[model samples]
Target: MTHAPTPAAMATRKPARTAPAWDRHTWEEALLAATLPHHGARLLGWGLAHLAPTSGQFRAGTSRDAGYLGQALRLSAKQLHMGFSQLERAGLLARAGAAATDGPRHVLAQAFTLTLPSATAAARTESDG
Candidate 1:
């Protein structure tokens, strides 16, 4: 059996290296921004910026549906809906349901959560590239 290394020996050894933190959000957004139109990227940016870490998912703070979001973002409700659909198809957003409120029947606002890439997934993507 071999004895443990001396403190001086350990001190001279190099420290372990770790993978860098995932920082591809802007890159991912840029790709989508180029593909989406009619303020789709703006809507996506708004949702992403408002995400709050909870449990295992990033939940959006705004629970308002398309109409309210449209008014706030200055885009038509139909335009907001189109943006939502595009982002959902791209796997960036997930709709849970409409917000709970005694509001208009015609309103179709949706509560949604953002799907962010995990560190492990980012590493995998890096390796694959």
Candidate 2:
């Protein structure tokens, strides 16, 4: 049987700190320098920046399409959904229901938009002619 790679082995190839505490110490400063609020807001900003392509009130996934975002983000669909909710509460995303299905209207999965400062600038640069 193949042995699993240990944390030390993983760190040899990837040196960046992903732990929230370490990221807060590093990226938090840079993020705060750009926008208001501190680490929590910064994490939300970063999440929004990453999720911009999917931000909107449109449908994200249907019952049959629950894994839609997983294919896009290469993350588990549940993780993607959780991240989306967090981003939404942070004002980085806006969502609503689609047209009625059978009984009452079914809520759309979600759409993505970038309202954060860094993300807004990045969106402009990419979208501009």
Candidate 3:
């Protein structure tokens, strides 16, 4: 005879997987809409799409601490800083502490919100015009 699943067994079962909250298409649209430079837009898009989202914010480490991001984006530390500045100006990103340092051990700390409604609106206006 088969035995019924115990409560402990049921509790241990993993939850069903669901689709990701954001997708490639959403990233592309946000990137296209942002008023940043090409590199800045690219960096922002990549960061939002690939980086883990913590409380709806995406954070970046110093260039030296680029980890997967630098290698994947093929951008130097200097380039990353420049992109960060551009995004900040456009109100897409916000940085904390000192700016990114060239030192290998130091990491530039930055964060940004996931939404890009302003950028999207600007893009729509440009397209409509």
Whole-model lDDT values for every prediction: 0.50, 0.41, 0.55
Q: lDDT per residue, candidate 1, 50-88, as tens digits?
A: 433342134443455455556666766555556655545
Please report, as a residue range, the 10-residue window in candidate 3 with the lowest summed lDDT: 103-112
- Candidate ranking under TM-score, highest first, comes to 3, 1, 2
Q: Give each model a TM-score.
A: 0.43, 0.32, 0.49
Could you give candidate 2's per-residue lDDT for residues 1-129 as a string of tens digits? 999999889878866676332222333344444423223334444543443333222335544243443454355544545554444444344555332233212223444333333556434433431
Question: What would you estimate as the lDDT of candidate 3?
Answer: 0.55
Q: What TM-score would candidate 2 get against the native?
A: 0.32
Name the candidate, 1 or 3, with the larger TM-score value.
3
lDDT of 1 at 91: 45
How does residue 52 of candidate 3 score in lDDT?
Answer: 42
In model 1, which runs have C-alpha deviations exceeding 4 angstroms? 1-34, 51-63, 97-110, 117-129
